[model samples]
Target: MNSLFLISSAIIIFAIAYVTYGAWLSKQWGVDPSRETPAHTMNDGVDYVPASAPVLLGHHFASIAGAGPIVGPIVAAIFGWIPVMLWIIIGGIFFGGVQDYGSLFASIRHDGKSIGQIIEVNIGKTGKRLFAIFAWLTLLLVVAAFVNIVANTFVSVPQAATASTLFILLAVFFGFAVYRRGVPLAIGSIIGVALLFACIWAGMKFPLVLSKNTWIILLLGYIFVASVTPVWILLQPRDYLNSYLLYAMIAGAVLGLLMYRPEIQLAAFSGFNVGGKYMFPMLFVTVACGAISGFHSLVGSGTSSKQIDKESDAKLIGYGGMLVECVLAVIALITAAYIGGDKLKELLSNGGPINVFSDGVGTFMTRIGIPLEVGKPFTALAISAFALTSLDTATRLARFIFQEFFEDKTKEKQSILVTNRYLSTAITVGLGGLLAVVGWQKVWPLFGSANQLLAALALLALGAWLANVGRNYKMIILPMIFMFIVTLTALVQLIIANIKTNNFILVLFGVLLFVLALVLIKQSYKVLSGSERKGMKA
Candidate 1:
């Protein structure tokens, strides 16, 4: 099969999903443009400031589209291209898109609160607290995995590290230029872009090499500062800027696919077993962010919801953003397929998933006459940028959850310390840093399960919210059920795997996630089955 055929097919399917299915969903959910968004009503020139459609979409997409789409699809392609492609398209549209859109819509309706808070309104406070803890832990895993991954990249690929460091500093400058000095966004963006390319050039010329452990410590310090700082200072403007780089990378890869139109050399199906794990559940977990990540729900509800300018914009920023990510995942699967299975396994053994994607994308770029030297650093820079942006976002989100968890208690106790912004950020980053040290090997499997489980729980929260609003919620409910089952299977697998390997910490974490899922499921079932619906009635 020609790569162009697959690429074209994915493009057609995504368009149809956006136009027909996405529109139908928007209509079904009764998206009202005139409704006041929390961003506008709660504007504080900080976390709650309203943003234009494009800016919000860029930040949202950049936050959620991290390494997951690239890493997940390529890793799971071991099961075969057919399964991975089908999941990325079908699951992305029907599951991930709905979850993102629904979570954003629900959060907007609830004063830009997180899914945890939404659960409190629909279920109860205890349920919300439980969900909040789960969210915080999962986000911790995200921070740990991402920090280690970024640090490893910096250690192994010094030019990428140099480029990433430049990206961060320029992002801060961009933020200050636009928000503080009142520079026009267009001018600031142009300056930022120019500086970005210069950074790439400089990175190649004067690479900043560091050991992995040193990089990890420095990254943790950076996260602490980034998280505690106001959103406008670093998170939003930086993410918006990095988002453009990500968009360019995607566009270039798509063009390469069209220009090269290489034949698929990988097997279409690799039976029902891959790397000693059964295909049914492992594939779903492995291909998580590429298909239906729970992490996205956190981002959509936790951060993006606060910045949306209008209710209707949620559909575009949330649903549309996810479909674009699905396209990237498709491109990743194609990269693996073109590289062939044995070569991919070798790449995994030698350099890891990041190397696999960079090498594959670099190879494609080479096919189109771009030299490997240029393509390699460019691809690495893109991936590192993706991870770095996600790192701060996740750190910030974890801070939010910590503050939210302690808000009422602190108020009741008349204590300002627990909810202090700096304190919360410090605690969050500290825990994540600790886990990143010991949980390096354990984070991926555990993170995948926890993340998907979070998604299932988030869907249930959204489903409950939809029910409260008296909207047609079958769309929300079906995906909720599917994710619930898939996540449960993953948790069970991890529990068994961890126990056999004597990894008690991961085993405990897996069991805790399973229990939390059960609790959320019970709450959702009661609401959906009408038994608990009357109690939640407004």
Candidate 2:
């Protein structure tokens, strides 16, 4: 029940996974440093720009480490610390890290294309289209969910809104300074951080409050611009700046844990039933990005793959990033457990998960002599930063999927309008905004199912790719099957719940996802079988 014991356990396991399993997978994938990476080979300066390992690592980690890790564990702690810890460590090491690394590996090898495109190469065009559509929908939920979450935080948690608004403005300033004015990253970052801290200070002193609907509209507008802008202009720079904040938050959580060393107060096992849902699938679905997330694959292939400077960096960025997120999830779990069940339930009554996280973390900070007024807003700022990074990143990735969906079949020259960035972004943001507005309650469960399902499909695609190339694929295949089964079970449970409640919208969505997953699995089997037969013939 000691927090230090749990924290140390997670660190040791994650370290082993990275040094052993991650390294072995890298070798099996044949990550050759001598070979040109997509970023270098296709350096276009806009989307495909070669970046240093540190910079790209920042972007990759920030994109993947969304509210999922923080909120998922907090909510799932209802089941107890043991189950959440077990899944975050075990699933993170074996399943999440593998999926993320495989995704980045496959995408880099395929000229920075997404896992959906990788599926097409290995599983055929139909598989690709189905996967792409599913990915797009998953991302739509991502955008909607995160947008709503961020907007709510801004409305209810005034300091969060202040910090986030400053963060976005600081991001644009940093981007412009570095890219346009030829300012060095070190200097620009220094100024940005200084200004950021000032904003944080100002936020605490003069918080901005708005209505939830108003915040939602403002967030949607920001998403539209952020999505449409070139990568260098906003997305990359913003994530990079935000990454520093994220790292500081992570470090702060560790420091607080070390200083306070609170005991885990929640039950080790909170029984099979918590909050009206069975713990089996709900736990898995709830504790998603903390353990594993399909969305990481999209971020990996969608943006990070295009910016990676070398193939050697993929493992570090992809696998290491997930491990770091796992660490954050563990921290979140600790914070939530220490907060006690009654306190958390009370916090949830007023605000969303951000309140739970901020309240928990703020309590820890208070133990270290920081006032709740300061600690609470600071933690809220961290949560808002996390969610907003995901919002823009999701919107941008959705844009990519939208364009990929309409790619010219004949390989002929396509019109600019057909492949226009703004147009694609408009469609992506528009759809996500609409969903966020109406489907707020309906999206989370469906999102969790779809998100994890995407991880399974990505793994299947990676396994198929590895098989065709004649490599050891057991590492990929086993995890693929496990996630597929877990996600399918989650989807089924969701379907039954929706039916009982007569939530036909979710029911329809669940059924569609089930069918898509079935088809993808069938195609994967065919691809693997065909590859085996070809090998025998040869």
Candidate 3:
């Protein structure tokens, strides 16, 4: 009956209500879920639609619910649990959920294109191109950050790296068997993952491969193939298969939280102290995806929309899936909180946030009759594999967004097909390869700022979309403004710190942020005060 546990549970419950109510309101305003959904009305069974709601949810959760939810929360817990927990609970439902659901609803109504496409229809022409380019740039950063995350696991933890390699190999085999061959996918995925867990067990007998640089190349190859292949074979199937690993992670965390009942270990506040430096920038950077992730919007509208079998499922997929990710963040916070004090610091210095999550998962596994050493590698591999999911998905989503940015000429002449899979693959591989050079050490600091800025953009887009639909729109505006201020402030602080430290790349990113902020502010001003929105409401 620790107060923290009670508080965490309460946060999750409130988030569900907030998102569900918003979705219901959207139904009232514009969307009629029953009246000929694009999923059912235009069900093509291949890309148009296929997965059941539960399965699709699993897929969405798997893809969006990656290292961000796990690692970010763990690191943010360094500021003590309150700040991290507060951000996740409140931000997920109100901020992240709105971004996801609004983007999905907007995409569906606009004929299942994408957020970038919706921006053109809803925002002005310039807004569309800016959104497209911004989306692509965001994806590049996502790939870079996630590549670093996976690479870190490889460099610092040998057993886990081996497991991650096996997971990728297994995903490939599983992809070919089920996706290419068209076997019973769900059952095949189950078997493949089962075998993978067993292989992970066997991997402890082999030598460890602990070269972060080597893994950077290895992961690049994985992403290249993963991006180029058909969604049925690689993206969908890989995500579908890997979701069970997520399930295992959840199950273990729940069991440990109950059995060990680890006390909430972090203080209510830690004076914003990070690395003995100012805490504001570090906290923001560390908590990127947990509190608010722009990446979720990409998942919401990209592949998830096409695969959604029913419009009613939007609440479940967009809202529910995001809330589930929030809970994962809470679990991460709990783990770090339980570890508490100096031990948390020791673990963080000795390894990284991945080690903290691994330690938590390994503890649970040990309780369930596995050795610590064995559980450690198993946890590591699972996480590394999770990182790959993020990399591939982000690359693909970014590519689609990039191509959409340059598609005006093609669309005007009716020559550009939206489903240009070949071009998209090129974008995916090119961006992924370009990012693989950056291992985690170089990229971790900016993850939060980028993620939050994206969240702010999504909110503005949603606010505009809501106003277009004729709702009060204030609900959307409040969150949008809040995220804009907090995140911009955080980014500014990070920039200042980078300048003092003589970090040129961070300075460049700071410039990028200012540009993005300028564009968004202008767009938002037009949405709020400009007469252009009067006649062009969607």
Best by TM-score: 1
RMSD of 1: 2.0
lDDT of each: 0.85, 0.84, 0.70
Which pairs clash in model 2?
none
Q: Residues 150-213, candidate 1, lDDT per residue (tens digit)?
A: 8987887799888888877887888888878999888887888888888889988998988999
TM-score, one value per model? 0.96, 0.95, 0.87
Tell me which of candidates 1 and 2 scores higher on lDDT: 1
Worst 10 residues of 3 by lDDT: 409-418
Per-residue lDDT over 1-538 for candidate 3, one digit per residue giving the tens place of the 0 to 100 score: 2534643584558565655776665655465656555666566644456566766776788888787887788866656677777777777777777777777766676666677676676676687777777677768777777777777766776666666666666766876786468777568866887887766765566646657777777777677666656565566666766777777877776665566566665787777666675556466556666756788877777778877766777777887777777777777777677778788888788777777878876876676777777666666676676777888788767756766765764455532434665666666666655765634345546666767777777777766766665655666777777777777887787788789999978788777876877786787677665455644455
Cα TM-score of candidate 1: 0.96
Q: Is candidate 2 or candidate 3 better by TM-score?
A: 2
Off by over 4 Å in 3: 1-31, 35-49, 155-193, 205-214, 272-285, 409-424, 438-444, 501-505, 534-538
Name the top lDDT candidate: 1
Q: Considering summed lDDT, which 10 consecutive residues are worst modelled in model 2?
A: 529-538
Q: What is the lDDT of candidate 3?
A: 0.70
Quote the lDDT for 132 in model 1.
Answer: 90
